[model samples]
Target: MGSEGIMKDVTKQGKATVLALGKAFPHQLVMQEYLVDGYFRDTNCDNPELKAKLARLCKTTTVKTRYVVMSEDILKKYPELAVEGTSTIKQRLEICNEAVTQMAIEASRACIKKWGGSLSGITHLVYVSSSEARLPGGDLYLAKGLGLSPETQRIMLYFAGCSGGVAGLRVAKDIAENNPGSRVLLATSETTIIGFKPPSLDRPYDLVGVALFGDGAGAIMIGSNPILETERPLFELHTAVQEFLPNTEKKIDGRLTEEGISFRLARELPQIIEDNVEGFCDKLMGVVGFQNKEYNKLFWAVHPGGPAILNHIEKRLDLLPDKLDASRRALMDYGNASSNTIVYVLEYMIEERLKNIKNDQEDHEWGLILAFGPGITFEGILARNLCA
Candidate 1:
């Protein structure tokens, strides 16, 4: 086949379309009010001023409540849970691994059911997380727990941080597009409770993650099959791009220390996004023959890294006031689940749009899903919703 002929064949096979999505959160609740007024206050008892400062910062995150794998009772008993380097931290990860894996299984089941109920049909599994930072990967556990075929191709992505969900989708798209008739199950989960380190006044940056991070898992079904096969709303993948900004390595850093994984969140993250987000968006829009045009006309599913991240992206992109409500709302409701967070935002977008179908005109609505991670990496997908 000539180049044009091959291109024609590829278009005929169609890109991967998101068939369904399911999300799960743990039962243990950690309300922001408790973290600010009680947990942190008690942990940082020696410094009332620092406690007060943390309380005020916690509220600014806009995360009201988050479900963690750790129980409040357990946390209370092990005050050192806030601080790592203990044998207790190792035991905590063992517990976290189980909980996070179960969450992934539950979410995957939901996605499978919504995608026509065929667990055996899943040919590939793309699991994303950064919670445990362990081995034997979550993908194998997920496959075994879900009773998938023995030959199922599995890929577990670790340490991708906040961009893991989009990373899963990008990989699933490639797998599905290359292997026609294959169904790709993408699962994203995290146990951020393990990342919560021992409280420290000296490393104020560590608290940025504690204040915003939470735990959750999300599953999305992507396949190369025709969109008409299922009634679920479809996000037909069009284009995706990943870019790492130059000289920005230190801006968003996460490192493991004696006190668990510590995050060094730059105060200027919002400014960085403001300065560079447009160029990234321009690259995506440019793919669909639009460059430097009106951005308000587009639908957005941005990763609300925190309240500041969302606000900065909105202002920088010159988007509508509510353009990032799903992202903001996810943060408010679920905190930042890291790699799993963006999928929750996408799930919210799917639920809201599916519930309020106004007209046939909206059968196809263009959207951009964006995520930010370490290395100052930007992940984006240009997609179109195929209404049920």
Candidate 2:
């Protein structure tokens, strides 16, 4: 199996820059055990049976818990939004939109400050998420709040699901590559709280979901050749590939139900990885002019969909258990934050990888980043580490 590069490997080093990156999460960390306990109390389900099932579901090679922005407490605090009759689904959606929008703006502002860039310099804004939905949504509101140029290109991408963080990177890379001297801000905030239903026969998993998911947001600043000159670089974009497997449609899906947005994850999701990931990696690596073995340092910033998915990938790729520690840690700490989860993993990677840097000149390390989503699609990037 020959490894190759899929897209144009932007080899001519145009100044490398990730001007800034910021992440935000709810204050409280929700434990899966606590969720199972709640489910047992709320639904009168068998505690022993439910606990055993939850233990299996919570088994991740790396993560154990996740942050929840709107717990039962947050909802209770915002009684106006969750009101009896007046607070329609539309109203509840508005509340979530407002909360996540503010989060994205704050994170973006922090990134700009850290990287020393002006909001005026930002020419494009990209927002990605699957957990929450709204119209004239977070990205547009964020641009306005920051007083960015009205002419700035605004992109609101949806339904990419968990893979959205890295997928947003790919989208921004294309925009930057085509527009000279352009700066873009990418923001992702995932909140599954609105989708948290009390219980229903249609969604037996809601109990697990209410326990597992948490709200989180991540922002990154990317710029073309000029800004890279002043910015501290983390990794340079080499090539990115988005691959969709044929006939594996039901692995993960987000659909609209009467209650709110519902998530359907097939029991066979692990098996889907078993059958497809190796070939997917083979094809992705082929696009980057490198074989798997030759790339000494690999950064697998995978979306922590759950414990089982991560474990399956680790086994399939024959990666060391520790290889996905950042991802597992993020999940244990934040749960599956849907689209924004990968950014947390990437943040941990950047923090750890940058610590050992000896110089700013030797930027030759190679890395791989992967994110999976509802389309049963995988978005991968082969990048060169620029931390030195």
Leading candidate by TM-score: 1
lDDT of each: 0.79, 0.69
Poorest stretch of ten by lDDT in candidate 2: 1-10
Per-candidate TM equals 0.91, 0.84
61-172, model 2: which lDDT tens digit per residue? 2345666666556556554433222334564576578777777777787777776766666778899866556677777888888788889999988768888888899998
User: For candidate 1, what is the lDDT?
Assistant: 0.79
Candidate 1's residue-wise lDDT over 1-388, tens digit each? 1112222234467778888888888887888888866655445555676677777789788999888876667667676765435645475666678888999999999888887746666789999977765678888899999999889999988888888899889999999888866778999989876666555667666666778888889999887655453435468888989998999999888766544566777889888977888988888888877768568767888888888878888877777786787898899899989888877888778766766585433422778989988888899999887755
Prediction 1 TM-score vs. true:
0.91
Question: Best lDDT goes to which candidate?
Answer: 1
Regions of model 2 farther than 4 Å from truth: 1-17, 38-63, 72-74, 77-88, 200-202, 226-229, 292-297, 355-364
**Runs in model 1 with CA error above 4 Å?**
1-11, 41-46, 76-89, 230-233, 359-364
